[model samples]
Target: MTLKHTISIITFLFALPLIAQEPDPSEAFWNRLQSHCGNAYEGNLALPEEDESFGGKKLVMHIKSCSDSEIKIPFFVGDDKSRTWIFTKNNGILTLKHDHRHEDGSEDNINFYGGTASNTGKANIQFFPADVATQKMIPGAATNVWWVTLDDKTFTYNLRRLGTDRVFKVVMDITKPISTPEDPWGWVD
Candidate 1:
């Protein structure tokens, strides 16, 4: 065989294993997270975030009480901005619901709900909120784009204002689970 042809054959053979490798990291990560589909925990998050509403100021938020279905989070910003995250999973779709209110019980800047992400529900560290329409938004509203990252036991979220380039990040450490159903927000009588 010609030298060039021989080298081509050898390269092809070597590349087969890489292509045929057992599961990809992403798949493995997804599977691992699926195991914790019904578990919850508590932890802390520390990250820098910026937004136009705050005049390009970055602040830290506190997170608590985490379960597969819901998470309670408190913002470090003044005025008692605390929120609860209700997550629902169904047929591989993970949805997010937000409720931020003061002690007096008033709406907190329009609670966010119906946010969806891939739902293997694994414990793997992952990043999300990958919609371009949501990434560019202005203040006073939540953008279509939101990102969440999970690492073993920590979860982080990145959000943008609706219509501008303002970006905000929230780091969360789960405290405990309040429920166990995969889809607590599912339709029920």
Candidate 2:
């Protein structure tokens, strides 16, 4: 065989494992998020028409902390840095939780409200229906379904309350990362 043929055969052999690997869209999603660690982005609300607290305030998302299987992102509404988003992966399942704290760094009563993905999404989108804990904590939101989508230039977080007219969405520009904010509430230096 010619040298070119031999080189082609070697390259194909090295790629066999990846070619035979099963698809894991969740992992792809996780990696996409992990790539944004230590960066911050500005966003705007695109639902509910208007809001008292969130309206007219600058919205920001700081993907400040990241690990192999966990990522913590702080969501800031103007000066209120009380909400953080925690994403975790275990046994190939992705989970999302809300970590809320007060200005004094005290945990809120209604915290960690989220759910795990249903493993029925693509690499750029994932849906997480409200889990048992969320239902028990906020009975009125029993039908809430949260989802996230990451594309080349934008990252969006959305919520839909099934059987109701409630919904929320925030679209952040990932293509333009802003300066990282200070540590979020309750987070020690």
Candidate 3:
């Protein structure tokens, strides 16, 4: 081979690995969330006033634990009961299984089920609760529709009821840092 041709081939070979590595858009978001394991953060649900015609109400959830596997968040709407959601990521999609049970290991108002939460570039989170058969349980129960600008520190949901055009925009803001180096997941007893 000629000298120029040999140098060209070497350059191409060196650049192959760099060219193959593509940046994952969800990496930053995933890393930020992963750091919140075993930590709790308080956030409020802000709903638009115009939606009051449909009887809108703001809700808040206390995120007790967060990890790559599962997230345990407690919704403090009316009762002190917590909803420990077990998350399983398949491919690029994330499925959160709702385990509605008390701290004593008893069933609550709802039973076990799986739900899909879509992360669209942190622009918003769309939740669709599914049945055990993997069908839509709630026609439109998505909540906390958040703005894209706050994607780094917050998440929003667009909640809807079954067979209804009424969409409630609820926002959840990350308030305080609850995770530390000592115990991030809070798994320790």
Candidate 4:
């Protein structure tokens, strides 16, 4: 073969690995969130102001634990530490799961129901549509879409149920850190 062709093939072979590595938008988002690791932020409901349970409660989110592939964020509505937002990443894919537990550290029936990212979203946001697991776990939740948006000033967790009038959004001010709350339900240490 000609030297020119041989060199071209050699360069292409060297670039194969780089080309095979898909861009993971989740990594950037994860790192943005990880920047707030070990910190807590206080926020309030921004969408519906008439939430009976979350209306007057002090809503706090603690970036309790973080790892290379997962982040555990405990969301406390008043004294109820039963809700946690679990963000897990595997093979460059991201999934969001809700971990619900009772005060006794027992799993709730409606737990771990969340979705996986349908695509590698932008740096500031990623959308997670209800996965099959969520559809099987909750009736009528098949249309749910959850997303988290993070920036230097704020972190927002949002949910929108397709074909319905249900939407939930919580905006936390990351610019100001709050005292980390206690361990969430079922959390050791």
Q: TM-score per candidate, in order?
A: 0.45, 0.88, 0.55, 0.87
Off by over 4 Å in 1: 1-81, 118-143, 161-163, 172-189
- RMSD after CA superposition, every candidate: 8.4, 4.5, 6.7, 3.9
lDDT (Cα) of model 2: 0.90
- Looking at model 3, which ten-residue stretch has the lowest summed lDDT? 180-189
Per-residue lDDT value at 57 in model 2:
86
What is the TM-score (0 to 1) of candidate 2?
A: 0.88
The segments of candidate 3 whose C-alpha lies over 4 angstroms from its true place after superposition are 1-28, 48-62, 102-104, 117-150, 161-163, 178-189
- The residue ranges of model 2 lying beyond 4 angstroms of the native Cα positions read 1-18
lDDT of 4 by residue, 62-93 (tens): 99999998899999999999999999988767
- Cα lDDT over the full model 3: 0.48
Question: Candidates 3 and 4: which is better by TM-score?
Answer: 4
Count clashes in each candidate, considering only residues at least 3 apart in sequence or on different chains. Answer: 20, 0, 16, 0
Model 1, span 26-135: residue lDDT tens: 45544444444445433232333323343333223333344444444333332333455545444545555566565555665555543556544334543344333322
lDDT score of residue 61 within candidate 2: 98
Cα deviation in Å at residue 137, candidate 3? 5.5
Model 2: per-residue Cα lDDT over 1-189, one tens digit each: 999999999999999998769558888888888998889999998886597788878999999889988899999999999999999988778889999999999999999999998784788998999999999999988899999999999899999999999999999999998888887889964
- Which residue pairs in model 2 clash with each other? none
